[model samples]
Target: MGQRTTVATTFGSAVRESVGSSLAAVDAELARRYPGDAGTRQPVHTVYVPADVFTAGTVREWGDRALAALDEHAPDAEAFAAVLGLPGELAGPVHERVRAKLEREPVEDLRIDFEDGYGPRPDAEEDAAAARAARLVAEAYADGTAAPYMGVRVKCMEAAVRDRGIRTLDVFLTGLMEAGGLPGGLVLTLPKVSYPEQVVAMARLAGEFETAHGLAEGRIRFEIQIETTQAILGADGRATVARLIDAGAGRVTGLHYGTFDYSAACGVGAAHQAPDHPVADHAKAVMQVAAAGTGVRLSDGSTNVLPVGTTARVHEAWRLHHGLVRRSLARAYYQGWDMHPGHLPTRYAAVYAYYREGLERAAARLVAYTERAGGDVLDEPATARALSGHLLRGLDCGAVGTAEVTGLTGLDRAALERLAGRPAGRGF
Candidate 1:
């Protein structure tokens, strides 16, 4: 047998000591700038309702309408799976979960839009609508019918509507405060952000609101909508989205792509302005990289195509939306916007199928990785984290049951969270 060899350090203790303080500063900056994912369940989709048309029953109404659409069109699991080209194995599970989700909590996130969806209105009219939206949202929460997340999308910070947008936001938040404090699920979205200054302004506004309401300093967080070309690439030739995240002051929860607006800003014709367009993909790719370790989520934009008209037309629209959603998921944009009730069925169907089809393989990989059992594919710790996150997301959206995941991987919720490197139950 060969004699054991001793290993020697390459650098002296004095050299490490000399850089320790500087490295500590770098460590602090990294911690501040690259906080990991917020462990809270991110919604699979955000449903937008025009503020003027929103009501306490809006969420349920959307669900019911989507259910009706499924009934009139793809009436069963096999039919739905066929529309989306779902695998045979996933047809039953995905369809059943989609229906159950629609029946139970169809709208994961609801945004009472005061931007493009709601359009401009008289000051008094907008104020009333804002207050009304707040009241209705509060009532929904009180009645246990509110979506898991609910908020409003105020108009842009462009000089034209800046003050009006601020006023509307104030009215809405005030109304929520009056109606038994802000709900835990309260969400806010600032749209058409073209500059980091605007993000800083938003953080300041949130800070002011917190101070005035005697709430925690960072209690009010908002998502920034990247609808302008400037938000993606500043005239300075720098990636502006990254600066926007830093400007958020730890209060930005998400970055939502605006398909039409961004596409138009890029001079793309309206007909070619779709989520899968090369321009759209580039914008989202920038967003994905910018938000990677910032604990900020990314949401893809919606399609204007509606599933109306004849059965064939509806089916065609469903197929298009499902393909777009699945493509977005494959690209790591897990959430998107649904502009109509008709989009809901396809949205859920696509999401459920994506997760269901990959559940077993992900679970098996995770089990192998955790057990240190060599498998066909060698997965690193980072890959193990990704695998666990996939399973967790599957669990979150009802695509896979906790029991099923546990049975497959022998991991409970806590184990999954640990492996995913997220603090259990952390959130906004």
Candidate 2:
């Protein structure tokens, strides 16, 4: 009966055009919100060195220095074991293993800083230094001494130093290109990005550099330093982190929080500026939310305390750094900045302890979840992914070996490998 009186539905040209335009807008917005594939191999930490102090083999040198300091302070594996609160039986072996790892791969990521680290120099001198850094990096790449992740931090793009930043970046890129084609995993860091426009400008400059050097169009990615209050809260009073990433036009690989600068922006006194300060926490939280699942990696700021001088002072410095690193790792930030060679040992120690301490529980939970398929354990996909990631990350950072993970989780090598290859948010 209803079919006998059926009515046809049609849209006028104007209405159809309007609907099409709205759909296109929605599609564009969705595309903008989509998180693209983040590259593989996010390093556990980044070591920042003054450009002047940088050399081709600086990573290995730092590792050697760290081991030497350990020898001087701890003297024996047992003493070092006490420092980390590790069992007496496991201390010596762990110490040797960590030392070997450090010597072999002292720095996962290295940043040659031209900002506070290098300060301002004569234009010609800065240019020469940039070129020299490029040459060293080139040599390091050729010699297989380059860190897996390496980059330079150029000055902020604020008006006062915008041109300076651009010039330094250009000089560095040109120098690096002349020395050799751009190395893999190389990223330029644009610091003190207080506005989205700064990110856009940096992206444009990177594109220009790539084109000028005949590099791939998207080869010149950069990291944004969330240093100022303005960077967190844009001029419009909205969260700016996502906007900043968008401004990078898919060239932003990481967002690193600058603890001191952010604390100073909050008017915290120098004595109060620490990585674990509430102010820093707020900044990191903002960054985490803004960049979560966006494929842009996040890094916490450095612990300014350096382990130097007498044994007592060195031990004290190590304690402070360890606390900071532990706090960062607890907060799910796998990467932070190491300001000195002395920070290397504590960085690895803290990271290893964090992962090692939780391995047993995490592995058990993961196995149960995988077997039961989420029954009494209340395991969600997120939980499974996180558990899998923990062990995989432990392996990646050299905190544990494949044999250990397999033994602990009852997962064969193939299973662990499968978990390692699985992206986040996927079921095991």
Candidate 3:
């Protein structure tokens, strides 16, 4: 959650520019002339938050209950969602209202999270609420731009959460599609993801949903949230993730560490306890390695800390501190989440800053190296070897754009297309 991407000195102005203009176009233009191509498509920066976190705003009272346990032992999250008693279909009319409410809001990115599977009330109301929430989430999604990322957090596979999962899916998806259709990519957040079999089950259900809706195949994808200690241990942990990938069969798009719930399962203490506890850190890295370049995005969990305080100075402090935290994680090559709209700037700033500084220096050096070769072009022998890796790394560091990469490497369209998944850093 606190992981930041690269950051820059002029981040303040950069943020203003990004929000005001066609960021995609501006970015594309910058990448055209650099030493390499700048065809990065995935947001070099993004913010994420579970649905439950949204209901809390910045208040501490809604704090995560399993803070310590999550740090110590990654446990089954769906079980918690079960305990929260969330699922079932809403009465049709009420469903429509919730959907409308969410659609009107200015929110762009939202995770329809099921906080805990525990709570009071075990009846239709809960189902209605779940349905209502999903509908509203869909509406919020509809009102935003096409880029607004959306996800559905179904109940876990535990007996308690299991039954609710299908019902939740059945009820909410209908509303979601009707509202604005699924997001660019529909992310199904799986909790308490213990084994690959659970993923298989989900995939089966996804298949059915696709058939029923007549949607194109493989349009749905999985995002796993590891929560239990049992789920993260030894060979069992590794096998489980591999299995999940197999189960989803190319449908698993990303892996996200669930800090609080994992801590709870391992007997960790306090929600505020550091997310990167030794055990948790190891587990997250493992998942990352397992998922690397499978085209599956790997994400660090959220920082539970609320951005609060009364003064503008204090709020800026919140931003800076979070910027550092997110920046740290971004260093690990993990994209982090932002719980609120205000966090958007932090996400991009860190990313832009990171790529901007590294790229500028690298670009300058690259240009100099080309000159030192006694030529104005990039193809001299000495310059070639020196700049090959630099070009690739520079591209990774966001220094040069796709066009520049192409110019130097002579990589074709397919190569540039591949680079699209990675971000660029012209620091525009």
Candidate 4:
């Protein structure tokens, strides 16, 4: 494939380039204003709605397992504590029965098929299954009042037969949206993005849908999953991302790392043998680097080694999880998925902790320097060094908001002026 595809766009280069430049500058300003974080953000922390949730069954086992997993990792477990019944927890007289019924009731499962003459994905039965899950999603977010930021990884339109799968998602999601089925953000997750053109096609579809539905938000955001070797290979990773960014439809929220399939593509000996294996780490590095400057967020693949139990198993796993998360975070990669909700805290802990400390240290240093510079062209050697230091910290926090540091450190505008070093002798 050619490095640059000759795709025609309605938008002009000047406008797009200008917009892109303005966006890039704004990102810098945001870092300076907010936090010094220049990291990738994959639409915040979330869970994958499995396929089984929508299937009617003795969901007891699944619920129990999910709860057990939550008991270990879900950072917001206290909110859902009633399920576990913590102190002052009210389960009611028939809590178990109620719980059982709730569990038995089908939910939106992206993995399994649901009701309907057909289901959620593999056609008829699959579409029906998807609708049920959609309905469940509506109810979960308050009677279709609002849907959380949910994205469905529908079957890609790769094969001739699979065209219907994508269409079903279109029809299904359209109906759902029409019926006030909106959560936080609606995203279409594309499984394997081979080239930029695929993104364009999807974006076009999204625009069409948005226009047809008159969605309050006239944008169909997309999350691209990079699973195949083709996506990750080639040292010219930056070129690949530039294309995606250009072609990204209205909304391209994130670029997710697909571990298993990626490994498969890489021809790794054992899938789970060593995620941090040099090969894996290198690939991750490429993904992180490519996403660094792009507006698109990056999400590392899941840590497949789920904890064995609820008893400090997470803590044990933390060393490894923290290692990978910290490295990714340090490299400016944000937003990683938690296959088991239990791992949520690890994600939050690592990210929050990293930024918290990193920001604090950066702020303290920057604040101390402010006492002397006196508003000079931020180009003075000292100023350059300070700016560089602050920028590094900014990258780590996924922000570059140096001003944000002032608020945190209790340094005022005056401090910034002094540190900025007042035009080198414009008088005091």
How high is each candidate's TM-score?
A: 0.97, 0.88, 0.60, 0.61
Give the alpha-carbon lDDT of every model.
0.91, 0.82, 0.52, 0.52
Residue lDDT tens for model 4, 189-270: 7766767777787777777776777765545677777776666653554446445545764366667777666776777766
For model 2, which pairs clash? none
lDDT (tens digit, per residue) of candidate 2 on 289-378? 888767788999987878999988988888888888888888989999998888888888888777777777888888887787544568
**Least well predicted 10-residue stretch by lDDT in candidate 1:** 419-428
Give lDDT tens digits, candidate 1, residues 1-428. Answer: 79999998899988999899669989999999999898888999998889998988888899899999999998988888888888888888888888899899999999999998888889999999999998988999899999999999998788999999999999999999999999999999999999999999989999999999999989999999999999999999999999999999999999999999999999999899999999999999999999989999999999999999899999999999999999999999999999889999889888888888878788888888988888898999999999988888988888888899999999888899999997886522
Model 1 steric clash pairs = none
What is every candidate's alpha-carbon RMSD to the true fold? 1.9, 5.6, 18.6, 13.8
Best by lDDT: 1
The C-alpha stretches of model 4 lying farther than 4 A from their native spots are 1-44, 54-122, 143-148, 215-218, 234-239, 271-275, 310-315, 366-407, 411-428
- Tell me model 4's lDDT, rounded to 2 decimals: 0.52
Q: What is the lDDT, from 0 to 100, of the residue 262 in candidate 4?
A: 72
The number of residue pairs in model 2 that clash at the backbone is: 0
Q: Model 2, poorest ten-residue lDDT window?
A: 419-428
Writing each residue's lDDT as its tens digit, candidate 3 over 1-428 gives 89888866755877887676867776654443222322332323233444334432311111222122221222233332222221222122222322222233223334656545333346575577666766655654455432235566777777766877777777777767667676563556777887667888888888888898888898777777777654555353344554565567767766777777887677778854445577667777777666644556666665555544443433453455345444444545435555544333234334433443344344444545545543344454444433443445434434346686566445643443333322333211
Which residues of candidate 2, in runs, are more than 4 Å off?
A: 1-32, 36-39, 87-93, 373-376, 410-428
